[model samples]
Target: MEINMFFLVLLILIPTFVLIIQNKRPKSNLPPTPPSLPIIGHLHLLKEPLHKTLHNMSHNFGPVMLLRFGVRKVVVLTSPSAVEECFTKTNDVVVANRPQLMQAKHLNYNYTTMGAAPYGTLWHALRRVAATELLSATRLDTTTNLREHEVKLMCRQIYNDSSHKVNFKSWFRDLTNNITTMAIIGKRYYGDEINMGDLKEAVEFREMMEEFFIVMHTETLGDFIPVIRWIGFDGVEKKMIDLI
Candidate 1:
């Protein structure tokens, strides 16, 4: 059949094209790469507690190695000297830009927020504002009493509820939020004394934050597996947009 002939020709041409392109690339002074498999490239070698794996690789290979995880290329450095060099004044400025991540695109206001943003005029301006107006040493010092007050309230709740199971993580997160809100706007959204309107807002805020972190931590398949992604597997994309 014609379809069989077409399939035969396609399979034969694809590898030939790949080989031709590989032969055309100029040689580079790249660092040694570990044995990697096609399409997954070193991903199969990764294990739980990723820092340990990187450490073992660096220990055997060298302090620095270029690695590819799925489709992303990463430079792993274990040497203190190499780290110092990378973050030195000149190199620091050169590499100050943040990488554009798929999750950040939705969660970080299109990478416009303070931490996710690329280094440029906008980032510099935001840094200046934070340094002068929000995170200055004087500003933090002025809020010491407020932070202590919030901590005492948290401790009081724990002390009163010592008989039952306690969600320490929730309590600590609320305590931190209360301190931040109190410092910025002189308001606390959590606690038994808050009105129903404020309580609703607090619940919504907590839900939003929980979903944000959950989605942010989970790796999207589209990010790693291009063929599946290109074929319109967009479940992660839809979930993120719906959550947003």
Candidate 2:
């Protein structure tokens, strides 16, 4: 009888203690957020064209608002003044680090590249190296001849196309592709080789570029939900692994 009574008293006391502690805990002093559901939070509230949805929400919720995406806390900032404050006044605090993107996690030399790296000594060193070695005045001067040659070829192609009523979009893409190829690999594969058809290499290159852009633009739920990242639900992690 005594044991049973003690057990009942313990259960009651535990819950009372828990409630007191929870009540004592300080609430976040952050800005208000829209109503959020449990577990998934505001995941289902998002609409097509995410930027438009965010803009509409900002209109109702004010320029600065907090949001819970999955288990992640997000701060949404709108209005030019708020943006100026973030970028100008609090630049170091606001933009101190880059998020770990799926591609960066796998393909970027363990996120060591300047574009993907967290802002610090390593990223600063990499940026300095790229600026000095790849983007120096001498490097640009060396590539000027290549650029001029590609531009002249583009002009010739345009002249030829004037009589044929060709597609301007295709012509422009081809011209840009030629310039990029020359800049990167020091070879212009514009027209054709002995085996390849006219501009077939450029066409293949453009197709590859389109595929890369599509992959990069895709949204992955794992980005918001830390738990789902381990499961690789969206295959973004797998894709990055394969690319690497």
Candidate 3:
């Protein structure tokens, strides 16, 4: 009877202790949040057509509401004025840092790429290089003929194939890929009539690019939840690491 009473008292005390600790903690100044579950927060409310769902939520929570996606806190700003405020001189530097995503770490050489890098000395240097060399007006004008030639080639190919059904989407994708690769590497990797000598290399490069796009865009659960990463519960994280 004494043992049974002791167990009953322990259970009662545990909840009371938790409640007391919670009541004593200081409340945060976060904006109004929708009701959330204990571990998952507001994840369950994220339905398909995410933009529409967020828009609807903004109606109730206001433009500057905060949300917890797994463990990460997100601030949703719907109004144009609120968005402008974040990019102003005062707030721009504060908000310029990109979230250190798993893909950026593995594929982008640990956020060293200009697109992935945080706004810092390295980014400034990269911007200077791009301005004077890669994207300068003189450099662009030099490449004008290359762009025109590629467009003419594509148009001729399309015209020749007018009798058959043409996939404009595939053609457009090829056109853009060829133009980008030519600009960056001095050779086009996509489309027919590629040099037979470089056919094997081109095929390999295309495969690599396709895989890169797939891995870059795919979401990993580890990005959102720390425990998922620590416990090795997210297989997508492993795939990302392997791809890199």
Candidate 4:
């Protein structure tokens, strides 16, 4: 009974001692942060419509606020001027690297894609190739005829369907998809031009794209908290691997 009481006291006192030490630690250089709970940090403070909540928090904490999303420390900049300064010519290079998310690692070829790559020689090469080969003035000029053809096709479709109710949203979406696909791959998959063989492939591609967006927006707890991922508590890593 005495040992049991001692253990209970130790358990209570240990966490209290740690909290006291943490509170006393120096943080003179860091931005203002709201009081956060242990383990979860500021996660409990967030609500639906996350952007609005953050904007509201800025009112009390100032434009530049430090927050912890689970175990990850995030510096929120609410003011446009503050954001612009953070991304200026001199600061852009320093902040070019993005957070290494789990989805990015598995789905983005181990972060080798231009958008996911860490700022380095590989990123520079990717940017150069995109500028010189994919998005050059000459490459854009070559797509002028393709854009006109797609627009004319869309107009004809609208005219043909004038007798019936037209879904402009869907038509515009298709037009945009067709234009982009034709520009990139010389094949358009979203319109009447698609054949039976291509139709199956196109359907699969569309489904894949929908799934990709769903995965991208998914809020996995493992992403912000390392132990959750290490213990496979969320199964997020498995889903990402399966997506790939």
Q: Considering lDDT, which of the candidate structures 2 and 3 is the better prediction for this target?
A: 3
lDDT of 2 by residue, 46-134 (tens): 99899999999998899998888766778888788877777775485666687776666665677888888998899889989988988
Task: Quantify all predictions' global Cα lDDT against the true fold.
Answer: 0.80, 0.73, 0.84, 0.86
> Which of the two candidates, 1 or 2, achieves a greater lDDT against the reference?
1
The 10-residue segment of model 3 with minimum total lDDT is 14-23
TM-scores, all candidates, are 0.79, 0.75, 0.83, 0.82
- lDDT for 146 in candidate 4 is 96
The Cα error of candidate 2 at residue 232, in Å, is 3.3
The lowest-lDDT stretch of 10 consecutive residues in candidate 4 is 10-19
Best TM-score among the predictions, by candidate number: 3
Candidates ranked by TM-score, best first?
Answer: 3, 4, 1, 2
Q: Whole-model lDDT, candidate 3?
A: 0.84
> Which digits, one per residue and each the tens of the lDDT, describe model 3 over residues 124-147?
998899899989899999889989
lDDT of 3 at 187: 87
- Position 177, candidate 4: lDDT: 91
The list of candidate 1 runs beyond 4 A from truth reads 1-20, 137-148, 163-170, 182-193, 232-234
How many residue pairs clash in model 1? 0
lDDT of 4 by residue, 1-244 (tens): 9978976886587557658877898867999999997656799999989999999999999999999887688999999999999899989887789888888888889999998999999999999999999899999899999999999999999999999999999899999999898887777788676878788889887788778878877878888866578779888788778877
Tell me the deviation in Å of residue 186 in model 3: 3.1
In model 1, which residue pairs have backbone atoms overlapping below 3 Å?
Answer: none
Q: Which runs of model 3 end up more than 4 angstroms from their true locations? A: 1-25
